[model samples]
Target: MPIYNKLVRDRIPEVIEKTGKKFHATVLSQDVYIEELKKKSFEELEEYIAAETGAEALEELADMFEILHAFAAVHGSTIQGVEKIRKEKEQKRGGFNERIFLVDVED
Candidate 1:
């Protein structure tokens, strides 16, 4: 029955322990989680914009995906669940396969 589950990353867990906060605690507050996700996204965006290497951009993008996944989890959904819905919609309507029309963008 703990609030705010601990998200461990390197020395974070140890640091939190020293600070007397419970590690791996369950997150029960929706508002708190939303704010946390927003902060995470902002931090990731900063790094993405400051990145000097192509690999860094990819890493930042991965971080963005993680943030999205966490947001879905907070709302009781998984990434797979989203994909299933997307696939169903595509099947019912049209997917990239049906978009035969193509044009060069840079031209």
Candidate 2:
């Protein structure tokens, strides 16, 4: 199967019928899509920052922007609008350093 294929509500039911197995598939309505996207974004961040193992910083950061774009759409903002805001923020509050520098403390 190809990664990152688009799915629809009807295909979900068709899959269920063909498989003959009970699998829960969530169909996010327009309203629920927004709410769920926000919740999922935070959950992913928590997993990245508040957990034991190291999370791929690039992958998680991409996920954050993916959800943020979805959020922009939900609120009727275009990509240009989002980009403008991003640039504004970058100019006002600079971007992060690419290097991950850490100081170790000795006991």
Top candidate (lDDT): 1
TM-score (all chains, Cα) for each model: 0.55, 0.55
* Backbone steric clashes in candidate 1, count: 2
Against the true structure, candidate 1 reaches a TM-score of 0.55
Residue pair clashes in candidate 2: none
lDDT of 1: 0.76
Per-model clash counts, in order, read: 2, 0
lDDT of 2 by residue, 26-96 (tens): 66689777677777788668756755544576667766777777778888997679899989998997777
Query: What's the true lDDT of residue 1 in model 1?
Result: 46
Question: lDDT per prediction?
Answer: 0.76, 0.69
Task: For each candidate in turn, give its C-alpha RMSD to the true structure in angstroms.
Answer: 7.9, 8.2
